[model samples]
Target: MELKGKIAVITGASSGIGALTAHLLGQRGAIPVLLARSEDKLRAAAERITGEYGLYRCDVSNSGEVEETIAKIIAKYGRIDILLNNAGFGRFADFIEMPVEEFGEMMNVNYMGVVRCTKAAVPHMLERGRGQIVNVASMAGKIGTARSAAYTASKHAVLGFTNALRQELRYSGITVSAVNPGPIETEFFKLADPSGDYIKNVGGFMMTPQYVAERIVKLIEKDKEELDLPRLAAAGIRLYGLFPRLADKLTYKMLNRK
Candidate 1:
């Protein structure tokens, strides 16, 4: 799992954790393939990377596009050593008030997007008999959060998917890891809440994208199955798992009251 000169494909590489990770991976000598819906942002990110980098404008939500794009990458590079399923989106709304299409969008991007990209890359990895897959989940994946029903469900599925992939590929010389990050200051927050209230309340504990990127590189090198950033948040997630009802009550009181 050495990153040096490895061929890595990172989805949602336009900004946030994906963009930072592309830079970090390039610095580590990995050839990064940047995939995102935004050609402008992808170009900028690829330009910033020092090593070999490719920019592909494709939405992860589109199965055909993802399949075609990954095929092109493999055809060009001859092998994919790392596949990072990091493309996702979030929508915060009461479950009852959330639109059906919004739920579909969340599932499509956060859950199915991972599925599509993984499906495209796994065959190549199996043929090569070696690869690493990293799914960027969230703290919400570990526990339900207020006004994030769809987002939480998508992330939970991501955790489940990564776990399954890890078990299935245990003897295949391929590694599957899930990086569960707490709140990080990124464009995702703005998409979740443009008003800045969510920022004011949750922003205090938010980690920078570069910090998460550093951890991702470490996980790739160590072949760790899961990496949780910010020790306090990891502790909170474990506690929430132990006391779901109490955690729900506290979260509702803290986030819903505002």
Candidate 2:
């Protein structure tokens, strides 16, 4: 959709993909509303945008906060043209050793955050019968691997929800799309692997967050259902779906390489 004058709400807007999108969207003439838990960071991010914008301190995992924050935004803008669900975090751990609390936190922020924001914003979109909901799921959701079970599970839930919503809105003007990208260069690694094993080993192959953000903005202007970035990774994902055993062997070698 044309971003000019469009009211766009971006979750996880404090940094990384969300922050970059906020700046880029503002450049495209969209009035970007930034949402995240950090007020300071949100303010800083909004300041970096060159056009008109606003920021809200929102913890997407909190239903009441998301509901109230989103309501205020809608009340002011009167219409929302885009909702980008990008607030998420991850960690590397053996499932058996991962704490239940950490797993629940993943579900809360990574999966339920999307649900909460979407729940609040979608009704407004439905009223207008024109909007875009883009969930930033991960390649991990499509192809599981060792060391990130909880993270993968949360993203899988996101894709499931996105697919269901897209089908439900199939005949309507509202569109739901999922962007499944491989690892991008971001603070996520420090958050995911404080010990740095995952970053030191696999991070070099990461995609640039700017590249992913640009592609997402372009996809929203199209009729695409989903986007799997880094075409090679997309191909590998398809292979894993078709031949799990072969994929397991290949992935083991790939991850161990270097």
Candidate 3:
């Protein structure tokens, strides 16, 4: 889809991939509607966009906030040509040791946040019969790793939802795509792995948020179905799927990196 003059709504736009994508979209003449929980950060992020952009303080985890924010966008912008579901977080902990509340929080913000935003915005897109939904999932969605069971499960739900939604909207002029990035240099690590071991272990393999953001912009322009960052890791995921037992034996040390 041509991004020129398009209306793109990006969740989690306070920073990282979401913020970078907003800037890229604005450069292409798209009206980026940036949403995030922090109004101050959103304000700062909006200033970074090349052209005019919309800023809304929204907590995606709250259904009411998400619905209200989308309504405001439609009322102000008239239509949503693109929806980028990038609002999510992760906490790396063993399932048994993880707090029950943390698990629930992951599902609420990471998985249900996508569901709520899509539900609120799709009807508007359906009215126009043209839109794109790009979900920012993770490589963890494709493979299980240690100390991130809750995070993995949430992203898995996102991929499942993205695939099914794509099939359902196959002929509706609404493209659904998923982005699975392995690791990135972002503030996410501050929250996901506070001790920083995970980032340290995977530092060499991490992609910059700029790189991932550029790929996402291209994905939307090309109308692709899904993307797995750092192609080598994508290859690893494929091998793991093909030979789970062998992969488990060979990657035991790496799997414990978290």
Candidate 4:
């Protein structure tokens, strides 16, 4: 869909990919409606956009907050042209060491947050007969790894939900897609890892948020279902899925290498 003058509501708009997407969309003439838990940061991010935008303080994990904020957006704007479910966080730790409650917290914010916002916004989109939905999942969602039990599981659920949602919306005017990317240069790691080991070791090379946002802008413009960045890495994942035993050997060699 053309982004020019479109009414786009983005969750997690206070920082990272969501914030970057809002800036780019504004440059392309779309009215970005920013939603996040922090009002201060959300306002700061919205101000950077080149045009007038909407800012709604919302915690996507809270059902009442998501419901109320979305209702407010519709009450004022009348319709939503695009919905970007980008609000999420990660907690990386050995599965055995991580508390079980952490899993619930992670899933509530990462996976169910998308469900809550989508459930609230989709009705208006349906009434309008045209809309776009983009869920920012992760490469972790596509494949599992060590030190990311809660995070990987939450993202996996996101991928599953997005895929199924696409099929359910097939006959409708609304479009659904997922953006899965490897690690990016962001504060997410400091929160997820904290000890600096994962970022130092497993994180490897990182993609700039601006670069990923550019690709996502293209994805929104075109009718694409799934987008995974860093073509080489995505290709490797595909290969690994096809040959798990060989992929395991290669992964072991790469990880063990000095």
Best model number under TM-score:
3
State in Å the error of residue 36, model 4: 0.6
Q: How accurate is candidate 3 locally (lDDT)?
A: 0.93
The whole-model lDDT of each prediction reads 0.89, 0.89, 0.93, 0.88
TM-score of 2: 0.96
- Model 2 residue runs over 4 Å out of place are 255-258
Q: Per-residue lDDT tens digits of candidate 2, residues 85-131?
A: 99999988888999999999999999999999999988888888889
Cα-based TM-score, every candidate: 0.95, 0.96, 0.97, 0.95
Model 1: lDDT to the true structure:
0.89
Ten residues in sequence with the least summed lDDT for candidate 3: 248-257
**What is the C-alpha lDDT profile of model 1 across 135-173, one tens digit per residue?**
999888987767888998999999999999899999998
Instruction: List clash counts for every candidate, in order.
Output: 0, 1, 0, 0
Query: Residue 223 error for model 2, in Å?
Result: 3.9
* Winning candidate number (lDDT): 3
List of clashing residue pairs for candidate 4: none
